[model samples]
Target: MNVKQEHLKETNPEHEILDILKNRWSPRAFSDKKITEKEVKILLEAGRWAPSAFNVQPWRIIWGIKGTETYDRLYNCLDEFNQSWADNAQVLMAGAFKKTKEGDKENFHALHDLGLFMANVYTQAHSMGIATHQMAGIDFKKAQKEFKIPEDFHVATGIALGYYGGDASVLPEDLQEKENKQKRERKPQSEFAFNGNFQNKN
Candidate 1:
């Protein structure tokens, strides 16, 4: 049971947006095809140009291709649920951030900056016809220990990358349903975007 990227693409939007932004989505299913090192480097280059507070550019990434020791170690850091589906990913990455500035002062915006970096990476990957799924279920401490990450850095999230379209039947039944879902939903702008002062839509 092969799935096509078009089958999962979001066809409608409340307002017009770029095709890439409109079409990009995170999918649990990934193809067995391998992504080349050059392509990975290009994705990182996109992230490298993302804006950061005070130009701190605090984002750091530890990535590995499948079948490597580093990939196995990174996979071990994922929670059982993520490991179940992410095992099919051709590439895995741990996204981290520097928690402190040069003088040891806390960089309060580090996490936000990291998000920006990942946004760049995600959009770039989409443009290149690659699919990406970001996962929050990971053992941060385990990743730090396994990668020998510095004390000043914090592991934030994990990422799975591969070519778009895959065998959705390989996923667990529940996730298979999700992978096959065609409609992409999100909160309307009215719920989050403010007119004047901030208003809690919740």
Candidate 2:
């Protein structure tokens, strides 16, 4: 099932915000289709353009695609269950951040900047007709050691990206059941954001 971007594009993008937003949900289910290296390079390039503190560009993308050393190294770092669903993904991307540029500055602002990079990864991929999923369910410390990441680099998260498969074979049965759960139920904006100061109500 080659799920191209056109089949996934929900809205006409002609003043239809809901159409786009409504279709933008993370899917753990990914197809076995091969994503081109060109697309991978372009997506990472988008991430490279993310805003960083003092132009340090602290983000690094360590990736494993199908049959490479990276595949084994990253798979071994996952926490069992994640390796189940994520293993089927076309690409396993590790988002790493540099603690400091030139090994100086008490506050390197890597975490803050890495966040901006991840945003670019998902949104840009979406616009390009690609689907991506960011995963936090991995042993970060183990990944750092396995990937030969330097002392200055911190493994922030793992991301599984590619086309999404539509069957339960691509995901665990329990997770598939939750696939269509409403976004509002996941996190209401009121709980995550406030009007001004600390307000108890949403």
Candidate 3:
């Protein structure tokens, strides 16, 4: 039986925030819709503008849409678990950080900067009505060798982009149950935030 996909949008925010942020939760079921090249550029441009230490902009993104050889390379670098669902995504990308910039010493904040870059990509994507899922489940060594990534760079994560699909039945029975039924969860600010100095909030 053909499992037709429905458009799905489910978000629950504990406090008032940008609608984009509220709507941006990763989905495992992605519609097989094609994403345009222009849209892909917009996402990358957003990442390019993210602030980095000393403006080094350490993050390096390599991306490809489905049906392209680049996509095959990117997809092949995913672990078996991620490959299970990531294949349905319209676009695949690898994020990496350059440990050093031209003639510069190792940047201690490179990883932190990459996180900000991805956040920018996520926000930009959500604004454009695109849903994205970032995963750390990747064969990092394979990504490096397959992509010819330099020794100075560290591959950080994988990103899958596409429209959200509603037909959870396409997934494994266990995952289908939680597809759109699960609630977004996060720890309260009190647990992480502090007044001035550390206090035993636990």
Candidate 4:
């Protein structure tokens, strides 16, 4: 089925924005098409170049494409709820941060830096007609051990990537309705972007 994503776009923004930003939205269903190794590298390279405090470059991603052993291992690390939907994704990733690559001192900003890295990955992938859905619902400890992540690093998130797939019928009735009709919602800039006093603007 040809799924229409234009309807999924956010309604009129307060201001204009890039198509990449406008088009980026996560969906539970994914096509079985495999992402090429070169395309995978592009996603990683975008994340690798994201800015970090003192240039620590703390983000780390362990990924595997569908039908590979690595992919199986990564998928097993997801919680049951995520596995139900993410199984259709062509690529799965374990995202982590090296807590202190520079020295023994803790890098307080490592998690925040990972967010920047993920944003870059999302943008780059969208540009290539790939969709990525980041998930907080993961078996972090399982991923850490399965991926052999070192003690210095902390597992943070998981990602499922692939070409878009699924129709509302593909999901359970409860989710199908949501899948077919949910609109993207976000707090207004005034609610979070403060000017001086950090209070909600009218």
Candidate 5:
């Protein structure tokens, strides 16, 4: 599948936004093309600049490119559902965050900061013609143990990174339907963007 053909699924945003943002969507199908080390570093750099509470910068990523022992370890941390398709990705990553502040106090905002870090990585990858899928379907405890993560940190998500547009036929029948989806949908601003007090759109 050609990369250009994948753009047909770009979202129809109600308001103008960056083309990269509009075009970005998580795909279960990934091209096997390898991502260069330099490109990986660039994506990490983008995450490194994300703002954090008191600049604690709690986010951390343990990543490995395909065909490496590290990659296999990361892949094993994913749940069975993710492993079904994520094996085709060129790179895999474990996203983690430090749970404590300097005094061992809880950093309630750690997960939020990690999300910001990922948003930067996602935008950067999209600009580079790369596609990324972030998954919560991972064995966090397994990832923590496999990576020998310290007690202060916790694994939160797994990430698959690769080029867009792969052979959907390689996926299971149900997943192939998702891989070939032509439209992207999102909640309207009114549903979640309240002008003042919160209102339950549901």
Candidate 6:
């Protein structure tokens, strides 16, 4: 299940290197295929290498394998809406960012920097034949309390990573259609980016 970066390209790649930029997305269906700890470490190592402002690495990850006690606790904390889709994941992770680094004043781009690192995690997992779907619609306050997190750390998102699951009928009707399609669709690049001037288009 080695997903070549080229195979994931939305369009042709003279536009961009498939591995560098491609159809990275979130999906609710997970194959319940447990990834080895070594592979998980490899994914995080990719995150550790992400660039940061003044080299301030503000990201922190709390993870657990499916069926573990820790995983149970973390899983229980999610809203039921997420639980239905996420319980099938082979691996679940809680993300947070240390707002203040020692000898520093400002919070540093805690959330933003964490986001960059998470991108690395996502891409690395994708290249490894793992699919990751992130959930921000989670209980941040509860995660902070349960994980015994420091006051400066802000819970960011929960992630579900594993292989793709079987069918779309497992999902709610609306989502079933999207899952069945299995194609990348977006509003339009111009709607989100501009070449210096803001010419809004969708």
For all predicted structures, in order, the TM-scores are 0.95, 0.82, 0.89, 0.91, 0.96, 0.85
Greater TM-score among 5 and 6 belongs to 5
Where does model 6 exceed 4 Å of error? 4-14, 102-104, 197-202
Q: Is candidate 1 or candidate 2 better by TM-score?
A: 1
Candidate 3: list runs displaced more than 4 Å: 1-14, 102-104, 199-202
lDDT of 3 by residue, 77-103 (tens): 999888888888899999999998768
Give candidate 5's whole-model lDDT.
0.90
Which pairs of residues collide in model 5? none
Clashes of 5: 0
Evaluate residue 191 in candidate 3 and report its C-alpha lDDT on the 0 to 100 scale: 80
Native-referenced Cα lDDT, model 3: 0.83
Off by over 4 Å in 4: 1-10, 200-202
lDDT of 1 by residue, 43-157 (tens): 9999999999999899999999999988899999999999989999989999999999889999999999999999999999988878889999999999999999999999999
Give the Cα-based TM-score of candidate 4 against the true structure: 0.91
Give Cα-based local distance difference scores for all models: 0.90, 0.73, 0.83, 0.82, 0.90, 0.77
**Candidate 2 residue lDDT tens string, 38-99:** 88888888888988888888888888787778877887887887887877777888888888
In the range 48-130, model 6's lDDT, one tens digit per residue, is 99988778898889988888987887897788888876777888899898888767677757788888998999888877788
Any idea how many clashes model 4 has? 0
- The predicted structure with the larger lDDT, 1 or 2, is 1
Model 1 TM-score relative to the real fold: 0.95
